[model samples]
Target: MCTIELCTIVLVMSDAPRLRHQVCFALYSASKAATAVYRPVLEDLGLTYPQYLVMLVLWEQEPRSVRDLGAELGLDSGTLSPLLKRLEAMGLVERRRSAEDERRVDVVLTDAGTALSARAQAVPQRLADAAGLSPDEIGQLHATLGKLTAALNSSL
Candidate 1:
């Protein structure tokens, strides 16, 4: 009886880590894994995930200023500078100083960048398939994640 009781105690303790105790850490890991999966797919187009995000914004709206992109992407100037430089180097984007305000920098897509849109049109569908989720599931997930992001963003 003593040995059986000891074994039961050990088994119970062993199951502790399996509980949803570290929700934040689990979410962080999930986010990184999702990005990893996107990496190879984005690389096939000669772009990084961050670069792809920048393109997504420009594809939706053209001839935006750097500050405008930064605000939309929630990136600071320091972080965006290098990413913009890389995109510019890849001939996918162009950065030029605004004539009206020398301090303002505009970010515009090049012909190559604009052309890349046709190739990218299928990415949303592909990602949806990869997620192994239905359209309704994706919508629900997006709504939940959006709320989570908004809450975190406001606190920050």
Candidate 2:
């Protein structure tokens, strides 16, 4: 079969939606594809996509509380703690009691993690090149996805 024929499925019943016609499936599939594109590049930098996301926040600002990080990343302590532990073991970050609030724990990037930021500087352009999306196209997609996410989240 040709590529389009192989990729597409049509249903006679209009009421029953096809998986291929699902926005959720498209988003899920695209998210996986984006992660696959990041996998090798992230591996080269000794990072997983989740770890990279954590680093991205810390790179922008330091000493973020675990609660704040969890809120920002939409992760719970159960999930975030292990990832933080792994990054800590990697010598990329440290978790410590917040100076301002003893009850809160803050995450700080180590010197190594700070340095990794420079090495990872080219990742965005590399991914854009790999995905073959122009900057304008990327921005538009980002905006659309952001709006979709917000709308979906608000409905919940």
Candidate 3:
């Protein structure tokens, strides 16, 4: 007869929950690595990763309400406000109160911001090259992450 000690089983099971095995940690680490890769590339364009994301959203559709931007970006007023302010200071975007609603603020891209879209167009391919991932692999990764995000959000 073979017998495994109860203490040995408990110790082994505990190791399963270690940081190396955590999905959250893996995602967190990967996000940090991706941002690090974007740092220098974005620096040349005078934008941070978060700012770039905001610009990307605006590039897709401009003159968005602060509330709309917040929801799309998954950011609250506190974080989005400062980012908008900074972009405004850089002459990249402008914020104004809606004529119909004094409480609503709309964010619109400046001419410079629109022109910057041309320069920023190369960022995606550059980032993919930096990560050494082909387009197919990047697409797969993006799809998998989308599913993961949906699963996690649904759970919450």
Off by over 4 Å in 2: 1-14
Model 3 clash number: 0
- Estimate TM-scores for all models: 0.83, 0.89, 0.89
Task: Give the alpha carbon lDDT tens digit for every residue of 24-135 in model 3.
Answer: 9999999998899888889988999989999999999988999999999999999999999999999999999998899999999999999999999888887788788888
The lDDT values for all models are: 0.89, 0.91, 0.92
Give the candidates in order of TM-score, highest first: 2, 3, 1
In terms of lDDT, model 2 sits at 0.91
Writing each residue's lDDT as its tens digit, candidate 1 over 1-156 gives 999999999999988776367878878877797787787778788888888989999999988999999999989999999999999998999999898999988999999999999988877776777889999999998999999989999998
